[model samples]
Target: MAHESTDTASENGPELQRALSNRHIQLLAIGGAIGTGLFMGSGKTISVAGPSVILVYMVIGFMLYFVMRAMGELLLSRSSYRNFSDFAGDILGPWAAFFTGWTYWFCWIVTGVADVIVIASVYVTFWLPLIPTWIPALVVIAALIALNLPSVRGFGETEFWFALIKIAAIVLLIVIGLVMVFTGFEHDGARASFLNLFNVGGGFFGGGLMGFIMGFQIAVFAFVGIELVGTAAAETKNPEHNLPRAVNAIPVRVLLFYVGSLAVLMSVVPWDRFDADNSPFVMLFSLAGLGAAAHIVNMVVLTSAMSSANSGIYSTSRMVFGLSTDGNAPKAFSKLTRRQVPRNALFLSGVVLLSAIVLLVFGLGESKGFTIVTTISSLCFIFVWSIILISYIVYRRRRPQAHDESIFKVPGGTFMPWVVLAFFVFLLWAFTQDPDTLMGMYATPIWFALVGLGYLLLRKNPKHQQLRRDHEERIAQEKREAAAYLAAAGSRKVR
Candidate 1:
């Protein structure tokens, strides 16, 4: 296949320029994956599953690796797939594109809100230990909005550093944990061994079935940003090379940072003693006699939250931009600023995020904010993942030649898709298994119904109809041009 051309010059101004480098793409992926979810939520998972939380993370990480591999294969197979939504549309149908794009957009919007809440909570440590949480929540929302409105690279660079801080912190924790395990340093005058893996409850599956299932509740959060690499494909300098490398590294990173660190943590302190309300990393630092452990961990968690929110903005804006380009959203969103950034779409996302702050101000508590936003975000992820599997299934059936030629094919291609689909269905069922998540599960279809209604209303608009027609025409024109070029090349060779 021909390499995809970087045609940003055709765009109106600097706004459409492809400015991202390999460093940016790699860091963005890292930032997107390591978020507040890992920092704060892991403690809950560990508490629930004890030592079994490690396996829960590993299993989820395994499944997500295939998901990313499937995405990578499809993306690398064709230059036209700017992102996963485009691939969904091309491989499945327009409805797939529409649903996947908007669903993914809504996903990040909710996730961003959750991050905003987390950021507010983190700030409360110093600002107002007793003040109502909503005050800081609103402030955080405003600050994030201001940061996002500038330019895409500015956002990318900021996220890069935010993610870097979290990455560095996690690395340091792991290294410290390893040293303590090997050298028995700070073992409180006792020898520390690698026996913590089984010390919690006698084995790796220490938590049993209930603990395992409960672990999934929080473990899934760690994989939240795994799909983010696909979102940055369009902006990467060399997506074919960088995208695959970045995506492939996900599983290893999960195992190392999540499973490895959690193992050491449980070893250092018994699983039963792990605190659910606070970060285990912070707790570990405190146990290790670090004076500023709480403050340092708080700083790391704050950066982690910022990283997640920044990625949420970037991914949501791109999804909206892709939707607008495909005639699913307003034309104004498709209009890129001089920097090649989707300023209008980014601004709209900021507006939605700001609304979450408004909700907070009106007495939406932190727990409520998390449930409302994270559940909504999770629902969107379900929709996006479902589309990918469905599209892969379609690609398998309709385009056997392409399937055979794919460079990075999803293993167990035919059967694995069904298995993954079943896993998703199980997750949806799991959500409904509990009263808390049940609400989110029920809320998902309502969101879909709203999207359907909006589509119907917008379909009637003359401008939207015209844009759709124009997009279709453009696709046809591109195909014809490609075919003619191939035909001319064939004729020249024959002559």
Candidate 2:
């Protein structure tokens, strides 16, 4: 059995480059926080939970913010940790890396498929009702592959603009909505005022406890890509300086982008009035008699779908690349092009993404297909996030000195990770309460079973056995060095 290269910078080929500047990192973080779910799924969420949907977004955001902070502390703890997969491998053993890496890859692939389907079925068909859904789907798949192949910076640049468009659209919606509320704008004799939120159908919880619980099933998918900052941490130019900044601002982003936007939308349109199948953004503008602006809002929502798909491609490729380098995946994926882009992994994801075309051309029906993919994507993402928190808990027990010396500790410390994990369990229970999501929940275990089987077979390979040996040796060496350094510091302090 041959020993694999532990060097991230391979002696035989190029590695991923640190081309993403602070601006790119900031926007990538923002883009990950905002997903197509906000624009496309918010209508359904509002219908399900009514005005209380605002609180759902805030609570989910708060929980995920702690997950990001835990990730930030772990990534910053060691420069060698390319992402959570690396640290999971380092701290928990090789199997953790294998499962986390492949699971995260699958998570994004599911998300990308849904994004492309929405682009083709919902947005493209809006303007070109006569065109086949597969046309735009294929076009989007090709364009995202091309956009990412050029460089990491290209992906960052694309996300920056895509995210900016989403932000502008939301800000414009909030501003217009406020004006409507203050002026007592009326349509069908229902005045647009702040009171409308609680005054409508059932008040804040008008949907009742059951409806509010169902809101979690719909809204959790909106935050699926929030951990992307962890994936991009290695490629960030100044990770220590920039990663915290990117993470610390998540609460503000959630409040403004998700909570703030939804509040204003519900305020202007009244929660019960929003159509579950239509974008609340489009509805808001259309009601204001801004037909042209409605079209523009439609375009922004279109770009938002594209952005999510684009991010899916970028993160999946990078994750597979990490898996390959760790000997969890094929060697070919570990090889990078001269541009420092993982071309092979990128093409693989794009090829798989073309499956969306089949779904589009066949008759899954846009709404049903979108629901299936988003449900599965949301469930898989929860698994990935739980792994991050689990790894953090392990890191804390193993490295208390590191935690004490850290500046960006998760606010509630070890206690908070347990709380968030409990919240996730409640979310899983919420899924069973709804038939649409329950099907996905039942289907999710098949994926894990397959991955578990693959891991079992890979574990038997001589090459993997040797790599595991090397991985254990590396962890032991790192522990010895850290202990020596801490002992020396203690001695100097005594003097």
Candidate 3:
């Protein structure tokens, strides 16, 4: 009945349409896993940890795969739940709804800023060295905003092609890299071989224990958008079927895309050879004397950055719209256009994106600006992800029947969430080891303090209090109905 209410557009307001198909969901998930971070940030990570960065990626991917599993199970548990934020509000409380929704919104904005920086500084400037960086930054922001304004399906189709391009590029890199390795391609007298992963540089832990720990700082950012599929839950068609299919493929995607590609990259060029500011994908072709291929890869990386910025704009708007509808944000954001696009919320994110141009104008060079922005983005996303895991734990506790009936239960049973949380704490400590990331870690709490003050003020509003009361009652009623239905079903089976 609740699902019915959401799908039926009201005369008073337009509801979000379930326009994203199975293919859209699948590609979007794949696109989320292969982010701009890999294209641009891997060079920094490789430089810091050498060949050990490959292991670093695998570990981060391993932990995040469980996080995705928790998210999948939570989304499938209730058909009426719009996204993780909806369940967070219902199960954790109103404070969580406000915090997680807004934090996740900020998460993408920060990530979009990083993506725009990479687009302008790393990829675009690679070709147009004489142009002002802000020119391209502004152009990218405008193009993405226009791409998202028409309809949800337009965004989906755009992402689908963008994701396809990224896949093709990575596949091409992996293929070329393998051919070079097998053919004994030599770069500066270092032969292309699997042994190159360890034989050169620091030999695995090239940067030492601290370097290995530091690898996670940038590596985690690479996985930031992996959960975009969870945000797209409401728009996905046949979510129960498609969501699991997409999520279940995460491990394979991580291995092939992140681990497989990086392993080959280091073998072909060795981790020490990568320049921190340059994209290794571009570097690989350039070093191999394939200038045309290098240019092509640069274009692919450019689109990869655009794809990430595109996801940031789309996810941020949907989140603000959800927050506004639930009385967590300004009501204007709740308003959707005739095409079911949240124009107000969309522009809000686009406006915040201008901060990218400011950073550029101030002369924050590619390497420094990206490090700072990505560090902040990684911390915020960890909070968003931690909220999802916590929400899942609470879901299992408060609604045992729902867990029992869940067709897609999270693996490792109830124990894995705590394990993943501990790993996040390790990552937090990793941030402190680097001065750049530590600066971001220091600034992150200011955001929470500000949001905390906002929450206090929000609670005093009489209208908000009434909305909270209504939401609490609805959640209680839904639980009762779910328990009763499960009981009846169990009795019928026994009889």
* Top-lDDT candidate index: 2
Q: Which tens-of-lDDT digit does each residue in 334-406 have in candidate 1? A: 8776667888888898878876656656656456546645766776786787787787776666555556567
TM-score of each: 0.87, 0.93, 0.91
Best model number under TM-score? 2
Better of 1 and 3 by lDDT: 3
Tens digit per residue, CA lDDT, model 3, 220-320: 88888999998898788889889999999998999999899999999998778889977898888776678697679778878888898999999999999
Model 3 regions lying over 4 Å from their true place? 1-13, 365-369, 467-495
| Residue 105 C-alpha lDDT in model 1 | 89
> Which residue pairs clash within candidate 1?
14-338, 14-339, 14-340, 15-337, 15-338, 15-339, 15-340, 15-341, 16-339, 16-340
Error of 1 at 34 (Å): 2.0
Measured on C-alpha atoms, candidate 1 has an lDDT of 0.74
TM-score of 2: 0.93
Cα RMSD (angstroms) for every candidate in the order listed: 4.9, 3.4, 3.1
